[model samples]
Target: MFDFTPNPTFGPLQNPDLKVPTAAMDAQPETIIVGAVIDAISEQRLPAGAKLGEQALSVLFNCNRANVRRALAALEAKHVVELRPNRGAFVAAPSADEAREIFQARRAIERTIARQAVKRIDADGIARLKASIAAENLARSRRDKPAELRSSQNFHMLLAELAGNRVLQRFLAELTMRSTLILGMYAREGHSCAHCDDHTGIVDALIARDEALVLDLTDRHLRRLEAELDFERPVAVTVSLKDQIFGS
Candidate 1:
């Protein structure tokens, strides 16, 4: 929040404008498409298993089909979308086994991340994490599910940033995306956005540099999130791409 370090590498977060471009844009057209789709999916605006038609995306993004393909490729690498051989891309829907593996990976990698982050996080990083929690709280109050999801994701990403490992950060990005995809597909009805108390405890432990406590809280936090998912249930297939992408 206040005078905290800024994150220049926040992916899937940069704004996306779907309207036809009347002039050359500052960012690459592919970046715009990728960010837009990621934001939509991360915010749960794009539900799991929703198809992402390249033609429609190109039309809406005011770019050629080639640009849309590149964007989808980027999303595919991140495990956000599954690109089929004959069929086009769709929002990822991880299998139940894949889901467990994802959480298991998060538990392993995030524990190491938490250890590193608590060691290196300065006062500024702590403050920013606190600010992120506050922002998440506000998003919750406003009943903004999309914003809440974004803030919740941001909170975790902030920890990854504090860990000072770009490789782990990048790996977690893919895993987190896939984990959310699984949750979107199989999470029980009325399961709300992630609880913040665990995050708060983690931040406290990190601030205190209590390695054991930080590790414990981080593991518990992820396990709680995983427990919320119910693989027995499935999200109905959504055919309306517009409704899926924009929630309109």
Candidate 2:
């Protein structure tokens, strides 16, 4: 149900007639395209299970099919997209069961990170977290929901990094993206103001080196977020075929 019309100010070229010279190719095209795609997905500008038509992407990004494939492959590796054989690629649609499993997994991983972070958190780590929180507060104040939501999510990833476990950190990063997508698909508005406060509590506990309290706070935080979603409705499959066929 997301709109795909090109924004006149910064829209991707819609079916440009000129070919991009391979010799003068921009290696950063994939990165740029992927970032935009990710932002769209995060904001629910692209809905769950929506088809990411390769031809459309090629035209949108003004890149060739080859680069579009590469970018999509990367997104797939991150579990952000599912590549079906003859059906082509679509934004990943996580099942209800998968959503529960992801939240449970996040609880375990985030709690562990919180406990570990308390033991090792330094001045720099605290500073970074404070900056993240400040940014979240600013976003909330300005009613920038996307920025607030992304910042709130990034705070957890920052905690994982503070824990200094590269393996766990990488896993959390990927899971975080998938979790955001799931929330966008299912979560209701005015779910909880606790998201911001939970983050503040965790930071306080970390600063105080209260490992046990940090673990408890993180567990509760994850549970509170899970409770916000209206999962009773069946997974939404509301993409428009016309929009897919003709550039919107």
Candidate 3:
């Protein structure tokens, strides 16, 4: 499993006092549990290969162990967590090969999504992409790496939405999270490619309604992101998942 260290951009990892009120707390315990895990992973509250103890999550969420297990099962289904018999669940740390495959899948799917989006491109879509880029720029200006990363993810999610294909959107969501883990694992020394200025180029092409350029831009954009992965660098230092999430 790839490891993750404390990213200054992600802020302090331990947030035991962190409390998020969930409406799902009432009718859907699993929903809350799943949301917590995904949020932690997306927000860097949980690093790659972090442990996810049923007892701790049950206590933290005031849910039952069965519910915790059920939630972890769902996360496992989404490739967000791994369940190891006799060991319990941990945040997934996809292998180098898996990471490459995820990117390859993304390139294939995103290329198709790009073509679909070009046909549906509109003024509103262009506006939204700019807005997302603006948010990314603001976060960068503030030097908030985590926020910038979220904004970057949002830009791609926006594309998935514009693709007009819910199935592809759902599939891309999984790929996006997997890609997040991959990037976190093989992150570069700097944020040049990670910042995603190429997204603007994509939007510009979309605004021009150039299908061919959109395809090239999106493929190149994803390729740039994939290129940022550095197998030569060291994996990050990891910690126990229970301790990481709950400060035990």
Best by lDDT: 3
lDDT values, one for every candidate: 0.77, 0.76, 0.79
Candidate 1 per-residue lDDT over residues 1-248, each given as its tens digit: 33423222222222343322222455788877776776667676666777777766765667898999998999888777889987988887777898899999999999999989978999999899999999999999999877787788888989999999999998887787677677777888888555687888888888789999999999989988988988776555454635547753
* Backbone steric clashes in candidate 2, count: 0
lDDT per residue (tens digit) for residues 1-248 in model 3 = 52344433234324542345222445578887787677667655667877777767776677789999999999999999899999988789988889889999999999999999999988898899999999999988998866777788889989989999999998998888788887887878784755367888989899889999999989888888888888876674345444557653
lDDT-wise, the better of 2 and 3 is 3
Q: Give per-residue CA lDDT, model 2, range 1-248, as digits (tens).
A: 75656433123233232124222445577775676666666545566777787777876777898888888988888788899888878889888888899988988888788878988999999899999999999998998876787788779889999999999997887677778888877888666655898888888888898888989989988898889888886655435565546634
Best by TM-score: 3
Which pairs, if any, clash in model 1?
Answer: none
Residue 174 in model 3: lDDT: 84
lDDT of 3 at 189: 78
What TM-score does prediction 2 earn?
A: 0.82
User: Candidate 3 clash total?
Assistant: 1
Which candidate, 1 or 3, has the higher TM-score? 3
Which segments of model 3 are wrong by more than 4 Å?
A: 1-26, 234-248
List TM-scores for all candidates, in order. 0.84, 0.82, 0.85
Relative to the unseen true structure, what is the C-alpha lDDT of residue 201 in candidate 1, on a scale of 0 to 100?
87
**In candidate 2, how many Å is residue 137 off?**
1.4
